[model samples]
Target chain A: MIEVEALTKRYGSTLAVDDLSFTVRPGLVTGFLGPNGAGKSTTMRMVVGLDHPTSGTATINGRPYAASPAPLREVGALIDAKDVHGGRSARNHLRAVARSNGLPDSRVDTVLGLTGLDAVAGRRIKGFSLGMGQRLGIATALLGDPGVVMFDEPVNGLDPEGILWIRNLLRGLAAEGRTVLVSSHLMSEMAQTADHLIVIGRGRLLADLSMTDFLEQNGRTHVQVKSPRQDDLAPLLRAAGGTVEPDHDVLAVHGLTCEQVGDIAAAHGLALHQLFEQRASLEAAFMDMTRDSVEYGSGSLPPPPDSALPPPPDSPDRPGATEVAP
Target chain B: MTLPASPTANAASPFALDGPVHHPTTLDVVRSEWLKLRTVRSTFWTLAVTVVVMVGFSVLVCAAQVATWDQLTAEEQQANPINGVSSALAGLSLAQLAVVVLGVMVISSEYSTGGIRSTFTAVPRRARVVVGKAVVLGLSTLVVGLVASFVAFFVGQLILATKHFDVALGDPDVLRAVLGSGLYLAACSLFGLGIGLIVRNTGGGVTISVAALFVLPPLTALIPGTVGDQIQKFITSNAGQSVAATGSAPDRLGPWVGYLVFTVWWLVLIGVGTWLVRRRDV
Candidate 1:
């Protein structure tokens, strides 16, 4: 389990992480979600003792990460994919890390196989592609078989197959009763892979809840009714205390369930062509909730095509428009 | 698509599947540092150049002096002995550069490649990591340096032996000079390491180290007279060069004192580097 309490990090005048607090429990995948520059990377760095926190504390398994006798054995983190030496082969690079933590050489081979890097284990890291580099980072994190595993942007540069592999790998890690904290800016990806989410914006916690709860609270559901007597249905729905909005050929009813709308239509003996509930997508809910918190939002749309300015009058054909040099 | 079985499915805990986990001692870190230093191609090239410069050039310089021995006047022969151990180690000035570069790379390469984060993550006690690197770099350079020095001494003396003017290890001050040359180069290597830690970038660390060892002494000499003498006594290469000298030069510390002065430069550089490592974020 990972617990962060009142953690704050300030870089110069800007607060990178501010007064953040949350607990990540085991047996589930917890997503650390934020937009760019939201302090996700800084927070992870502080958790592993790479960066000092300005105030407060972060603990893995009830102790500061550095205080653990076997730090790599207690917590495994893949902070950056390009942390390996390019001159060294993949096997030697992992061997050096393993040897530092007193892990057996055999475990290096195991992690290599687990990450599907055994085929090119003897090649220098400089030759590996970005996807392979990510795989190496994952292999390094799993080298010690730690109880807590954290990955920062693990799927940043990956093929579809590689992305799927990591999604399953994260679920499996949590299923094994290990605490997994994965950070990403992609909300749709989080919606699929994460069981719970700790959302942040501008270094502050925006929401700390489960996926189901988030969807239930922010996701809107409305019933749509299309019929030949839509004008009659609209007044009946409004009279029954439902807010009704008219589309091109249908009536949209809010604050009422599909069954209620169906019963109301039947009671009026109105022939209904269609009546169904439309639930908002999680992506839409996420966008709506984080709309005010986005850091780099554009304020207005671009100018129309007709607004393109005419050419300047300094051409040779318009010689009089050009002023003489002083 | 079939999912792979969970790595920890059957295991009760992380340690249970891996058998008993071993927490790394400082010795293990030192061992890993040794492996790290030797595995890179840069280390191999640096050491190879050091050997060629120190040993190969020593033989060539001494051989050239002998070929011109007949043209020298009696006073010239008396003042500059051709058969001493110092003459056998004449190439050290050029060879020192190779050792210094390797020493700086021991730490700076990790910083440049972003590997220091991985290293510190595995071993969070930053002091232990630095100390381990120092121990490995110091000891290996001492060994390689001693081998290079001995080879140079023997080869140069072998050429001198042809003219019946050779000195042996049993000769007075012969063994000390040869052994001291090795110690001098080893100290120079550690001096590079200290600079490396201070400036984490490879290019900057190497430039500063090279300038301190090779450029500053002559530049200080341009000051002239007593002021120059005082400044030159503390310059790392000038003060340290006495260790391998066959005889004492004027206005310089004796052999051991010069080594001690050279050692202080490393201590101060390393102290500052260690302080910064603890205070700064990776």
Candidate 2:
């Protein structure tokens, strides 16, 4: 488990990470979601003791990461896929890291084989493609078999195969009861991989909830009704307290369940062709949740309605903020 | 299409570090650093080139001196003296750049390639990493410098013996001069490593180290009067060369003192660099 308490990092006058606190539990893949410059990278770095926190603490397991006797064996992190000596071969790079933490030479070959880098392990990393570089990074992170693993933007530059490989790798790691925290900007990716999410925007925690809770709260479930007489059914559904938006022959009804909408249509003797519930996508839900919190949001669209979102009761906005976990 | 077994499940592993995690010892870090220093082609080629330049210059200069032995005027020959070791090590003035390149590359390349993050991740004690690199690079350069110096001295003395002006390693001040050159070269390398750590950029690190050792001395000479003379004595190359020279001059500092001055410069650079490294974000 990783416990971050009031972690704040300020770069000069700019606050990179502000009063961030969260716990990444084991036995699940926790998605660390944020837009670019949302302090995801900085937080991960501080967790691993690469960047010192300004006024807070981050610990892996129970103790601070630096205090751990064998850092690599206790917590492994892949902060950047390209953070490697390009001149060195993949085997040598992994060996150096393995040896530093008192790990044996054989582990290097083991990780190499696991990452599918054994075939070209002898080649210099400078010649490796971006996907290959990412695999090498994963190899390094997995070399010591640490109980906690954190990856920052692991799939930024990967082919479909590489992405699939990483998705499975994360799932496999977490299935082994390891604490797996992976950061990504894409919620669609997270929806498929993450069991829980700790989302941040503008260096503040926007949401800390399970993928199911997040989808339930933000991803509104709506009933779409396609009828032969939509003109007659629209008013009945609206009068029944369902917000209705007409698109050609179908009515998108919100704030009511599909059964309720079906009953209303049946009461009106409206011949309905189709009535299906459209579950709000995690991507749309995430976008709606973090829309205001985005630091570099494109200003082309007007700001979202304030009433559309209420601050999550447990969102850590500042020091001593609420600790809400789903 | 072979899929390796999961790391956590591999019980056949000879390196299952279960139970308690032990912090790596200094020796472990140093050994890792040794592996890091030796695996790269740049480190190998740079040191190899440095040795070639140091010894190669010795042979070339001695050969030219021997060929012109008969044509030179007696006073000309006497004024243009060749210390058997100094002549052999003369190529160091050119060869030191190799050490500088290797030194700077040792740290700066990590930044350029983004390897520093991985380095600090594996070894969270940032200061230990710096010390490990310094110890590894400094000792490696020192050994190479010593070997190259001895080889050059022997080769140059052989050629000088052709002209009947050879001096053995046992001659007065010869051993100190030869040994001092090796130390000086090693010091130059540490100086480069220190600068590299500070800058963390290859181009900037190399340029600054070169300017300190080569450009600054000549620039100080342009400074007018006794001020220039006084300043030049402390300039890295000038102070460092005192250790390389066979005889002491009335105006110059002692050999060991010069080495002390040069050594202090590198230590200060490395100390400040490591301090900043500990505090700065990767």
Candidate 3:
């Protein structure tokens, strides 16, 4: 388990991570979701002890990282993909990190094979493509086979195959009951991969809920009924225990199931062309929950990810994107 | 704000997987440092140049001194018979540039490439990693430097044999000058490494290394009399040259005192470097 408690960092007057606290539990893939400037990377650094916390501390399992004897064996992290010295070959780079933790030479080759970099293991890191460099970074992380693994923006520049590779890799790691904390800006990826989501905004936790719980808590179930005689059906649905918001061609009906709406229209002798249930999307829900906390709110269309999952609801100023726990 | 888990979480329990045995040991760090050194093409070329320049420069300078011997008086010839052998080590002036650059690259490249984060993550005791690298780097460079200087001294003496100015290793300070010059070069390189660790930038570390070793001495020499005497007595490269010289120049520093001065310069820089590497963000 990786525990970070009340960790804060200050660069002059700017507070990079402000009293940020979260835990990466064992046996599940926990996706750390946040927008840009959300202190995700800074928080990870504090966890690994790379950046000292100004106020509190971060640790792995139990004790402080500095106090840990086999740090590489306990908490392996890929904080930056391009962290290797360009002048050194991939093999030598892994060797240097491996030797630091007192691991044997065989482990370096093992990681190379595991990451499928044995072919270019001897090539200088300067010549590596971004994906190859990321592979090296992941290899270094797995060198000691630490129980806890943390990856910062692991799929930032990956192709589809590479993305799929990491998705399966992380899931496999977590399946072994290891603590896995992965941070990403994309909501779609988190929707599919993460079992539990710890969404943050502006350095504060917006939600720490399971995917099922998030969807259930944010359930805003309603029904849409469109008909030529919606004026006659509106009074009938309202009398039948439904809240009705009338539009030009449809009545947005709440508190009634789609089947009930259809039954009510037919019983009232109103011909309905369209009747369907409606619930806010996950992306729309997420946006509504974190609307106020977004540090880099951009209007640009997000790049479409492979997941067919839709966007959650737009985050609200309060919490959980206007969560209506049903 | 929902703060992350505090540092004090799970402070009591001792896991079987964790303890003092888990941290990186000195021997492992040394091996790691060696890998870092050998992997760099620049390190190989730097050592090669240090060797080639030391030997080739020594031969040429020794020959020039031998050819010019006929014009000088016996007194002038006796006092400076080795043709400013220490001064003929002028190639070291150029050689030190490579050493300084290599030293700076070792530490600062980690920062430029964002690899410091990975390295520090592996070895949480950051200071030990730096010290281990410094030790390996200091010893290996010194050994190579000694070989190069020795070869240069012997080859130079062989060329001077024709002029009857051949000086043997048995001479009072010949061996010391040869071996000590190598050590001096090594220490100078380490001094550069120290600055690099503290600076943590290629441009800044290199600039500081060059300024301290190259520009500082020449600028301080113009500091007017005794004030300059007190200050320049401790500049690393300047004091190192004095320490390796068999016979002193009119304005040169004393040999042992020069080494002390050299030590003071590096010690201060390294102390700061260690502190920063320990306490600051990687």
Candidate 4:
């Protein structure tokens, strides 16, 4: 378990990270999400004692990182690609770090085979591309087989196969009861991979919750009705206290059940072309939760209204958001 | 090694960086430092140049002096006071540059390549890291310097044999001169490591070391009197070169005294460098 308490870091006058507190539980993949320059790297640096925290503390298994006798065997982190020397061969590089913890010479070859760099282990790092470099960094992180493994932007420059390989590797590691924290800006990827989400923006914790809870609390639901006599149903919807918006030839309604909408349409004897319900996707939910917290604002003009409007809350979409999973 | 159910690192566990091992013993740190020093291609060439320049140039200078030794008038020869043997081992002025560059690269290369982060991560205790590097590099250069200076002395003496000029290791003061020259080069290398640590940059450290040891000492001697005396006494090049002198000048310190002054300079610089390293962000 890793506990970060009131962790704050300031680089000069700019607050790089602020009062961030969270606990990472074992046996799950926790996704750390943030845009560029949002203190993710700085926070990781402080966790490893690479950068001193401006205030607060971070601990792994309830003690500070530097206080451990064998740091490599406790937690492993691939902070980034910049933590390697270019001239040393991958084999020798791993050997150098491996020997530090009283690790035997044989373990170097283990990591070499694990990262699939066994073929090029003798090659100098200066010649390796970004993908190869990341492999080497991963090899180093996994050298000691520690309980906690963290990666920052692990798939930045990977090919499709490499990406899938890393994804499965992370899941496999977590399944073994290890604490895994992977940071990325790709919501689609995180949605499929992370079992929990820790979202932050502007160097402050915005949301810290499980994936299901976040999806539950964030996205909106509504119902859609397309009827020729929708004008007659508008008054009934108003009487039902359902909010209405005219979306093209359809009226989108909120706060009314699907049965109520159907009954209201039948009473008016309106010929309905279509009646459906819709709930937001995980992408939309993430965007909604982080819209205001987003550090980088595109400032683009809002999109123009379209004919294919969203469904009303009275539709099936309403039940999707309202139904709580036990 | 078997993987324990849980890492039983009790008793104020200090080496948990989420990556990289920590608190590696001084020996481990030294081993890693040695690996780091030699793996870089630049290290080999610099040391090679140091040996070749020390031996080759000293032999050349000695042979040249041998060629003209018989032509000097008796009074002029007395005034010049030839020590063909000692002069042959006098190429440290040029050789110091090679050792200086070798020393600077030991530390500065890490900064230039962003490898210091990895090094510190593996051994978080900054002081021990520097000491480990100093030990391996100091001993390596010491052995190499002794060999190179000895070779240069013997080869130069052989070249000057036909001119009726030669130096024996048993000759009065010759033993000290030969030993002193080797010590001088080794001290210069350590002095270079100090500059490298303090500057933490290749260009700045190399420039400072070369200028302080090679460029300034002789120029300052032109100032004359107390100023020159003071400058020369402190200059590592001038004071360090005392080890190779057949006879000491009144103003010049004894060879051992000179080595001490130079050693002190390196120690002070290394101390300050380590302090900054511990306090500063990587």
Error of 2 at A261 (Å): 5.6
Predicted candidate 1 versus true structure: per-residue lDDT over A70-113, tens digit per residue: 87777789988887789999999999998888888898888898
Please tell me what DockQ candidate 2 reaches.
0.41
Please give the clash total of every predicted structure, in order: 0, 1, 37, 15
**Deviation in Å, model 2, residue B159 alpha carbon:** 0.9
Which ten residues in a row are the worst by lDDT in model 3 chain A? A317-326
- Model 1: per-residue lDDT, tens digit, B177-233? 888889988888888888998898779988998899998887887788887888888
Model 4: residues >4 Å from true position, as ranges?
Answer: A219-296, A300-326, B1-23, B222-228
> What TM-score does the A-chain of candidate 3 achieve?
0.83
Q: Which of candidates 3 and 4 is the stronger one according to TM-score?
A: 3
**Per-residue lDDT for A19-95 in model 2, tens only?**
99999998799999977677888899899998889999998877888777777777779888878888888888888
Higher DockQ: candidate 2 or 3?
3
- The ten-residue window of minimal lDDT in model 3 chain B covers B7-16
Candidate 4 docking classification: acceptable
Which has the better lDDT: candidate 2, or candidate 4?
Answer: 2
- lDDT for A43 in candidate 4 is 78
**Residue A111 local lDDT, model 2:** 84
Question: For model 4 chain B, where is the 10-residue window of minimal lDDT?
Answer: B8-17
**To one decimal place, how large is model 3's interface RMSD in Å?**
11.0
Q: Residues B1-282, candidate 3, lDDT per residue (tens digit)?
A: 112232113333111122223446877877888888888787888788888888778877877887888999999978765654553464677677777777887787777777677788888888788888788778877988888878887787777788766777787877778777888878877888899988888799889888888888877777888878767666668887676678766566788778777877787888899897898876
